[model samples]
Target: MAKEQHKTNAMRTLDATGARYEARFFDCPEALSGVEVARRLGIDEDRVFKTLVTEGRSGAHYVFMIPVACELDLKKAAAAAGEKAVAMVRSRDLLPLTGYVHGGCSPIGMKRLFPTAIDETCDLHERIAFSGGRIGCQIEMAPDDLARVIPLSRADLIVL
Candidate 1:
């Protein structure tokens, strides 16, 4: 018998929006680095994106998605969000702010829809993968499909 698929808020949000996506699950009881996740799933690290939450100087939160292997450039992120500066939100504050734990954060279905940006590199891929609002699951879909569900701006968010 096949394992039952776990439904997540992110998945449900996509479903409500009529977005097409594929869910990939793995045995990850503990948090793993993004590169490790890509390796375990046999996906190119560049095709696996990480969702990052940051607070602008004005105290507004913002979301950014970038390739797992790359580092988010704070200056660029701030620029994209139209803030004087931005800093990553505290790990402990993540759950209360976004309704997600540190490693399982997803761009979709957050506690609130904050201003969001996707790394320009995403345009190079036909599909990208991100957390499915849980530790062991990932959602894969075309970038355009994701944008249709969540408003997203394209920016150069990663370190070169």
Candidate 2:
């Protein structure tokens, strides 16, 4: 599959940050999981990250990133975000706020700015992978950029 772009928050955000990256697209099968995404991109499965939407206290939405191999602990995530608890936000709710579909959502240039968290597990890879405003399309960037550049909250989210 070839990369496709029709203008998205992710592209705008990348341009704004001056992060040099090339967009690559894969088959985007029904199972568009991060693990398959990494393999399609010829990278380690752990190097690929996934964006997730969660509801905090009072129905406030939050963004979080974690590796395909690890799981996001709602308990720890709530503590990290200073919320009572967190649960997966419905895909229906994500499109309205982020202006992107579920699999395509990216942390960069979200429609709104909420407290964002990237699992410390991301540091395990020198170059991390994330969705590029589309299910198949992805961008590769330095892990440090997600921290120093993006300035997102970081936590050791993986139980392992």
Candidate 3:
């Protein structure tokens, strides 16, 4: 007998779009930082991204993806989203707003498709990895393929 794999909403969404992706799973019982995840997966931190949700001054929600080793510059992010300012949504509000718990949020399959931006640095990579809509899983795919699944703009979003 073999164990059946559990498909997350993110994985299902990718399947529906016919996007090419690789689902990688590791032993993670609780939430961990992106860098930690990369370390556990024996992957380069630069190729791993972390999803962040923020609320703009206009009350609009936005998503940003940046390399695990970098930090999101709020000012740059706001500029990318065309907002006066943006602040990270509280962890308690993540589930209700994005249908994903902290540390498990993926840019795809959110409760709603919010404005999304990926750091321009992502373009430098042939492929990138992000949360697979769960704490213990990851999804790796080409940047262009991800853009085909979700409408996103590339911007300089990381701190200098």
Candidate 4:
């Protein structure tokens, strides 16, 4: 049997919203891409989402959720966020800005709420997984349930 993982801030927030989710942990000796993580978890890469932080031209912060197998289309992302342009937040700035590290960022809980968007493709899956606020930890739940836990919009944020 797998050991129960401790609750993370993200998990606590999800619980507060009464959203159901499964928290899991996987061995992560090296920082791995979301795709690799999903592969190791024996799940479809499309069902595993990665949380990304980006800064708009106006200096406003934004968050995006996309499948591990796809890349965020900066142009499409900016359009979805109603920004003139946007760029990924520097790795070092992730923790200070969102209170999450590079490999463990979660769209669910951040230091402050930012405008967030998830790839519309998420709707294709009944359940999706994302980092559980820590590297090596993951949380799986319905996309709609995740939306209820946090204000999020679904859009074409991924590169086709």
- Candidate 2 vs candidate 3: the TM-score winner is 3
TM-score for all models, in order of appearance = 0.97, 0.88, 0.97, 0.95
Q: Residue 26 lDDT in model 4?
A: 82
Report the Cα RMSD per candidate: 1.9, 2.6, 2.1, 1.8
- Which regions in candidate 4 have their CA more than 4 angstroms from the true location? 1-5
lDDT of 3: 0.94
Query: Predicted candidate 2: what Cα RMSD to the true structure?
Result: 2.6
Q: Judge candidate 1 against the unseen true structure and give its global Cα lDDT, from 0 to 1.
A: 0.93
Q: What is the lDDT of residue 54 in candidate 4?
A: 99
Q: List the residue pairs that clash in candidate 2.
A: none
- Where model 2 places Cα greater than 4 Å from the true spot, the runs are 1-7, 29-31
Q: Candidate 2: how many backbone clashes? A: 0
Candidate number with the higher TM-score (1 or 2): 1
Question: Which runs in model 1 stand beyond 4 Å of their true positions?
Answer: 1-5
**At residue 121, what lDDT does model 2 achieve?**
73
68-99: candidate 1 lDDT, tens digit per residue: 99999999999999999999999999999999
* Predicted structure 3, TM vs. truth: 0.97
lDDT of 4 by residue, 1-160 (tens): 1233577889888877888899889888656999889988899999999999999999999999999989999999999999999999999999999999989999877999999999999999999999998999899999999988889999998877
Cα TM-score of candidate 4: 0.95
lDDT of all predictions: 0.93, 0.78, 0.94, 0.91
Q: What's the TM for model 2?
A: 0.88
